[model samples]
Target: MLINCVAYQEGKKLADIPIEDISEYLSHPKCFVWVALRDASPEELATMKEEFGLHELAVEDALRGKQRPKIEEYGDSLFAVIQTVEPHGDELTVGEVAVFVGANYVLSVRRDAQQGLVGVRARAEREPHLLSIGSAFVLYALMDAIVDRYFPIVDALEAELEIIEEKMFASGAGAQRDNIERLYELKRKGLVLRHAVMPLLDAMGRLYGGRVPVLVENCQEYFRDVHDHLARILGRLDSVRDTIGTAIQVNLSMVAIDDSEVNKRLAAYAAIFAVFTAFAGVWGMNFEYMPELKWHYGYHMAICSMVIVCGYMYYKFRKSGWL
Candidate 1:
């Protein structure tokens, strides 16, 4: 669907149009046109690209849905790409959102609109300020919404990590291995988001370098605010990654301690077994000259000696706190 927003000093409002009316709709000076397309055919995209006079590089970037997040200056406009993440089952589903921002209009296209762009587009229409605030505000507002979604995803990951951490303190190291896999997956998602956002920051800075047109300059602070928000979100992701690292280390450390305890106990038991085994082997020689074999109490005495030795060893272990 094509959405055109007219920005005024007080607020903004939007007008909806069919995709084919983009050319006619863009004729208005107040028109900040947004062409949000979903699953357009190659032919449709090619025609739109030519109509909008988009740079070949920008066109190529849009068609190549997996392109990294970036921003570039075309002749009179800036093209930016961002990745929006969706919660898909037990993991995140990522898709690209490509945008073209000019002095008068902004065009955004996504491979699929199910990732939440529809809600944002609807919001711009539902709210008066959004449609009237020019392309810059719209740009930042859209970015802000996407960034806001990341918070809940990250929070869920942190909560899961907390549970795993508690288990790390307990004796469930083997069972928590899957949690490490989940942590790694989250870190990978963060890495993907960083790749997409970092370039946009550079693009935004360069767009405002030295001087910007009055329209963009007026909204420069808004850009800066969104940049700050992106930075803070990235910082949270980094902290989550580090926390995951520490949790894994804690798990390993606990496993090592448990293994050491098991080895110490096994060593004590093995020593006791060795002493009794040797005593049995020597007495089993069955020489006719062995006098103790004739005494009935000899059997009891040997058993008693073995029990006493084991008891003494257990007492020593308890004293040393190795049991």
Candidate 2:
């Protein structure tokens, strides 16, 4: 669905134009048309292509969605794919935004992403000085908006790792188990956010230096700012991944330690039982040569001996911290 189609000239809004009137504004010097679409259909993309002279491959990629985060240059226009990250419950939901930017027009198509660029448009219009740079500034604005959204997710993942670390030391078996699962889940989300941000680092470099796109030549600093944000996000993602890996290993070690403690207790109990069994097995044997059985106090003496020996063993086990 088309969200908004507005035209701008001299860094100010002209009017909200219909889709059919996009070409007329495109022809005007110092004017650009901005169109926003949500889950755009192929027919809509085709019409956009016709209006903005968008590359066929770019339109195809936009219509299909699910493209890896990237920026590609086709002739005089640029196509960029950005992944949108949003928190859904305890999980992260990923979406895509495909932008087609030219000297005279900008088209943004969003898919599976709940958040839109309405704020970006408003901010751009409010800052006419930057918006006056033309379509490239719009591209930078959209990229900057998407990149900014990633900071909260990175912080959330970091917070989750800290929680899991605390649980690793303080929680019981069941809670620790849940923490391990939670850690893995957060790691997965971090990776998803990483994939979304990592590719843009290199792709965006082309916009700032060395044969830079004409529309972005004067806005190198803006593009560079976006790159720095992405780099920071990628760095934090790496840290989160390493921390999660360490947390998982620590959790496994805790499980092993618990198992070892259980084994020691079981072994201690078995040792105590073995002492009594040994005494009974010896006394249970029926033979003519059994001299202790001939005495009346022999039965009482044997019972006392068994009890004393077992008690001694129990005391030793307890003192050693095994029971």
Candidate 3:
């Protein structure tokens, strides 16, 4: 799908191009275009490659669709690959965002159509005035929303970390184990997010660092805004990493405390049983002249003694907080 954003002044649109094939309109500096393509087939890639003079290496990366988050200098244009974040079940999935950017236009392609440029497409359709800003500004707006998705996901991880912190004490080994797994999951997500966003910061820096043609200056502020967003995101992810470390430590301490309490209870039970076993063992030595054998109440007295010893041990254990 194409979202055409034409340049404007005094509430007028001058020229327009397919939002997905914007590289074609770069010759006309008075107007700019942005094309957002998704799941482009091999034929589509061929057409795009021909139109943009895309390097074979870049096209190969785009077609194969597993490129790491990076920016490649292609002389007149720069090719970049970034990830689009989405949740798939309990874990998050990274969507590839490929772009072939030139002097006056930018072409963005996604690995799948499911998440292609719907948000940006909607914005352009809803507000025709955005076309007046130029290609760089439109690219910034699309990329900005893509970056913002990281914040909420990170916030969710933070909230989960807080909950796990509270339960880490009272929970059992099973719960602690689950929390550790969750920590690893959160770390993985953060890494994925980092892969998706961190490169764009450098890409933006390079773009606005006087590398691009004069047409992009109009959109420098927007790219800087994106960079600031990324910086804050990176900081937040770092904080979560620290919190995960603390959670693991607390969980370990709690497990140790739990084990100690259990051991103390077992020891108390063992002490109580030891008294009964000793009393039985001593009295069971069937000797002909045993003193207890001569007494009628010896059996009753021995029973009472055993009960007393058991009760006393129970009381001591309770007092010592070993129960």
- Which number leads on lDDT? 2
TM-score: which candidate is best?
2
Order by TM-score, highest first? 2, 1, 3
Q: Write the per-residue lDDT of candidate 1 for residues 1-323, one digit (tens) a residue.
A: 33332333234444455556667756666665666666556676686776567787888778778877676667768777777777777766778778877766666777643665767766766766655677766677677677677778777777877776766666654655655666577667666666656665566664454776455665777677777777777777778779878877766777678788888988887877887898789888999989879997999998888889878978888788777
**Residue 311 lDDT, candidate 2, scale 0-100:** 93
Whole-model Cα lDDT per candidate?
A: 0.69, 0.90, 0.73
Question: Where does the lowest 10-residue lDDT sum fall in candidate 1?
Answer: 1-10
Off by over 4 Å in 3: 1-29, 121-133, 209-218
RMSD of each: 3.2, 1.2, 3.5
Candidate 3 lDDT over 20-132, as tens digits, reads: 53454555555444555677777877876776677888888888897777767776666778778887778788777887776555677787524556676557545556556
* Candidate 2 lDDT score relative to the true structure: 0.90
lDDT of 2 by residue, 115-182 (tens): 87899999999999888889999999999999999999898889878877877876466676887889
Task: Write the candidate numbers in order of decreasing lDDT.
Answer: 2, 3, 1
Q: Can you tell me which runs of candidate 1 are displaced by over 4 Å?
A: 1-15, 18-21, 125-130, 176-179, 207-215, 286-296
| TM-score of candidate 2 against the unseen true structure | 0.97
